[model samples]
Every structure is written in structure tokens, then in C-alpha cells.
Target: MKFVGIFIILILVFSCSSEENSLEQYANHPVKFAKQKIDNPDNDFSIFIPKNWEWKAPYKENGNDILGLFANSKSNKNGFKSIILVKKYKSSQNSKDLKSEFEYLSKQIRNHSQIEEIVDFGSTDIFNQESYFFHTKSKSDTNGDSEILNFLINGNIEGIYYNLTLSTPQTTDFNTDMAVLVQSLKTFEILK
Candidate 1:
């Protein structure tokens, strides 16, 4: 009986230690991104949303600048949320070149007062076409100490420029969400 009791205690202690080790490993391991294809209801273009992100129906904008918008369902619409906005421009110029499109996007954001930092994330392929990535922080009035992660990307298709943006507060622990967003952006496709 004494031997059995000692063995059971040992087993319990080892099992608890193993669980702690697993948790440590999980915290140290890099996150893998997830991607899911989403169809565009307004046009032939299709985009990808990260795991757990859902489609948001396009609503009437206060202005004519927005073409579409999407967001992660878990986001708070009233608060700082993770979302993608599709901007449409009517112009005769072809904006398909990824580098130029990125420059244009950078230029547009240069004057925003709320933007705290802008980092050039370099170029990444999306929809088999080159896409430029940028990381930025925007001030959140609600979350005083928290910074917002803004993921911006742009590409031109058929002489039109489309800008997609994703933003969420950093306090939410959005590392995996950001990775998923990047992966989803990589899968973006627009039908010509």
C-alpha cells in the first residue's frame, strides 16, 4: 500500500510539470497564420480573412470614397476594432505596380495626426501580384496606454486602385491575428 501511494504521488507531480512545460513551449513558439477565402459581394474581387474573422456587409458610407469594408467578427464596432476597408478611386491612370501603389498609400497617411509611427513592412505577394505592406500605430482615445496596429496594403487592378486596411488595438494580444491577416492578404485575388 505504501509503494502504491508513493507511485501515485510521483505520477501526479510529473503530470503537472509536463503541463507547465507544454505551456512554456506554447508561449515561446512562433504563431502560424491562418487564411480563409472570402467572396466580394460588390465585385469579382475576392479576399481572404483570418481564422475567426468574419465578413461585414458594406454599408452606405458618409462619402463616396469607400467601396467595401470587412472586419473580424470578434471586433467591437463601437470601439477600436480590427477591420479592412476597401477604397475605390476613379482615375484614368493604371496603378497596378505594387511599389507605386505603396508610395501612394504612404503619401495619403503622412498627414494623419493620430498616426504615431509608420514602419515600412516591405513587399509581399498578394493575389499572385506584388503588394506592399506597412505597419503603423494609431492613437486610441478609449485605450489610453494601448496602441492600435494598423496593417495597410494596396494594389491596382484594371486601372483602379484599391486600398485595404486592417486595424486593431495592440492590447488585445493580436500577434496571431496580425499574422493571420498577413496570410489572408497574401491570398487576395481580384477577377479581371
Candidate 2:
């Protein structure tokens, strides 16, 4: 009986330590803005993630793959919020086909019933690549209001089509998050 109690205590102690280690492995505390580049070994592309941010594993949906980077613990209900989502769009049209490409994207967003407002940010060049940038506010029954900063880049490397987006909740300050997001976007490189 005494041995059983000792064994139970040891198991509890190890379990608590393991949980703490797992949490630390997932999040970086005392957020700081620094430059870090992520190079993909399996693919011919890579990008920089701003300081105070960490990238999560790519998830799949409807036969599509999406990679997300977060500014903080995504599980946190209230925190400095931001996300950079990267995805590939299989298309025969080259990256220079920005106009038609973005038009398709615009059409998709318009289909979302909860989107309340969309603010056009026009076209700009980053990393020598032409991109269309915009902001949208979405109202949902569960999420309330969310401010999304969308970036569509015609990464003219080879025949690959890719787009990167930055989204955050309206509860957070947009100016601060946008600065970090834009800086990271500018550092994107096509390593093909």
C-alpha cells in the first residue's frame, strides 16, 4: 500500500513537469520583435516571420494545405493578435496574371455573408513582386468583429502560385500589428 502511494506521487510530479515543458515548447514568452527566416527544404520557397511570432504546422482542409504563423498563443482569448496564413493556389496562369488572379480572390471574399466592410488598399510591390493588399471587417455571431489584412502576391517564381495574408481581431490595435506584418511580408523570398 505504501509503495502504491509513492508511485502515484511520482507519476503526478512527472506529469506536471511534462505539461509545463510542452507549453513552453509551443509558445515564446516576453514577446520581442526580431527577424527570423524560415526556409522550406521540401519546397522551393521560404519567408521571414517577424519577432514575437512563431509558425505552426500546416493544416489541411478540403484537400488544400494551409500554413499559419501566429503572434502569440492562438488559444489565448485576449492578447496581441495576428496571423500570417500562407497557401498555394494551383493555376496555369503565371504570377504576372495579377489582375485576373486577384479578381477571383475578390469574388471569393464577397461570398462570405458575415463580412461587413472591405477597404481597398490598392496594389504595391514587395520583394520585387506585385501584390494586392486590402482590409476587411467581419461580423460573426460567435467571434464578434475581426479585422483582416489580406495580401495576394503573384510570387513569379517558376509555376507556383502563392498568397500570404495577415489577420487579427478588431479588439487589438491594428497599427502595431500591421507594422510587424508588413515588415515580415517584405522579407518574403522565392528560393526557387
Q: What is the lDDT of candidate 2?
A: 0.59
TM-score of each: 0.60, 0.65
RMSD of each: 9.8, 16.7
Model 1, span 1-192: residue lDDT tens: 999999999999999765412212322446675566667677746776766776665633545344665565464545555665554553234455546655665676667777776644556544345555556666767633322333334434444555666655564455554545445554556554
lDDT of 2 by residue, 1-192 (tens): 999999999999999765411112212223346767776544546777864466653532333333333333243365344677666555444434766777777877877797787755567665466767666778765545666667776554433466677665555444454566666666667665
Model 2 CA lDDT for position 72: 34
Could you tell me the lDDT of residue 138 within candidate 1? 69
After TM-score superposition, the amount by which residue 181's alpha carbon in candidate 1 deviates from its true location, in angstroms, is 1.4
Residue 53: error of model 1 in Å? 3.9
Q: How accurate locally, in lDDT, is each candidate?
A: 0.54, 0.59
Model 2, runs deviating above 4 Å: 1-32, 57-59, 64-80, 92-96, 140-144, 156-159
Candidate 1's TM-score reads 0.60
